[model samples]
Target: MSKPEFNSLNAIFINCTLEKSPRVSHTSRLIDVSKGIMERENVSVDEIRFIDHEVPPGEKPDMTEYGWENDEWPELFKRVMKADILVFATPIWLGDKSSVAKKLIERLDGMSDKTNEKGQAIY
Candidate 1:
């Protein structure tokens, strides 16, 4: 079979389900939305990036060394840099996005355009 054409629709799913929030249900709902977009657009999806903010016991999740790419360091920024469109779907916690989502947002510093004084994206 021929390989499918790759179209851009970058997706980021962040789980912010406090300690008792229903996470999977919310995420499933978001997935349905993404699927609907894909079906409506008639474009092939290249990738879906899912970031789980819920950490394991005694472990810190950092973009620099998240173990997703071994101990080589720096993976999240690389992925973000390649995405053409970003979709951030996160559960609300304490009336705000989860800390994991916030961390992911902070990591966006590496992808900044660096032209604007306020770091407004030029791309």
Candidate 2:
């Protein structure tokens, strides 16, 4: 069998900063630098600021099914599943990752069992 072709890679950068858009986020700036380098190598990049969206906290694939009035995790998760690379950008708080970062991680754990078309675990 022939080897699989590697045309390009898709990356999703999830900024888990506490601050919203238009606000200064050191973590986000760092992500931008990395994003530029990846783009130079022909990688398709997508960014998501966790704070800007209303993503209710829950340990499930879709929080809406868990009684959340609205959830953005499902949509964001879709992007994550489609990407070849996942980048979480968050500032260190008290020697630990930010809350947004933790939340994203937990939410991701909800889908830890997810697999790609080839049945390989996404994580």
Candidate 3:
């Protein structure tokens, strides 16, 4: 096995289902479809089931700094940072995405002055 080229396209999919793993997630099935399409195009795809991790809610990049003892977003954010694309998969309820999804979006939006190698803002 060898490292992918620096220019290789990569994507990260965050499944914001409230349901834990070992259980079926229709949204994830939908992600599988998109993942397959990207894979066919030679894109590396990484999947993260958000519910399985302990990511507290906060506007800061790291909730731990905001008095949280444990925040998984820092580690998760690393994955988000490394990807060329981020696909957030969320289940809709009453015509709105799940709370978890909303929180995730907020966190992403709250991203501070971090930019990619191209000098483009990552949000």
Candidate 4:
């Protein structure tokens, strides 16, 4: 069978933090929101994404490459760009967006201007 067309259905929920004490871990709140969205949309009707951000400082324990650019980051970016809708779930820290979400957004800024070998933005 042929592969599904891009953007047929896609969504992402990136939680910035979930530390618990700090006004509740942002990830925890995001998961609740994500679950509701998935339920409302129905499991068979749409695709749902949940990006869990819960890691200690320094290199990512799940990482298996020299750097993110050479590893999962690329694939994750592709997924995000392919999505029809993107949701950024984060908490306010010191009256500002959580650092994790901020960094992810910053990383995504370059996606729009990029092009594939055939010259196509992921969006």
lDDT string for model 4 (2-119, tens) is: 8544334565555556354335554566567675766565422222222343222223322334343333455566556665666676667688877666656655664557777888
lDDT of each: 0.47, 0.89, 0.87, 0.53
| lDDT, residue 72, model 4 | 45
RMSD of each: 8.1, 3.8, 4.7, 7.7
| TM-score of structure candidate 1 | 0.50
**Winning model by lDDT:** 2
Assess candidate 1 and give its lDDT: 0.47
Q: In model 2, where do residues sit more than 4 Å from their true spots?
A: 1-7, 117-119
For candidate 3, the lDDT comes to 0.87
Clashes of each: 0, 0, 0, 2
* Candidate 4: regions farther than 4 A off: 1-8, 18-26, 43-71, 116-123
Query: Which numbered prediction scores highest in TM-score against the true structure?
Result: 2
Q: Estimate each model's TM-score.
A: 0.50, 0.88, 0.85, 0.55
In candidate 3, stretches whose alpha carbon ends up further than 4 angstroms from where it belongs are 1-7, 115-120
Q: Arrange candidates, best TM-score first.
A: 2, 3, 4, 1
lDDT of 4: 0.53
Q: What is candidate 2's lDDT per residue for 1-123, written digit by digit as tens?
A: 985443488998999999999997899899999999888777899999999999888788888887889998888888988899999988996899999999998999989898879999878
Per-residue lDDT tens digits of candidate 3, residues 1-123? Answer: 985553488899999998899788899899999999888778889999998998888788888888989988888998988898989999998899999998888788768677868998765
lDDT by residue (tens digit), candidate 1, 56-89: 2212334335444332114544454455555565
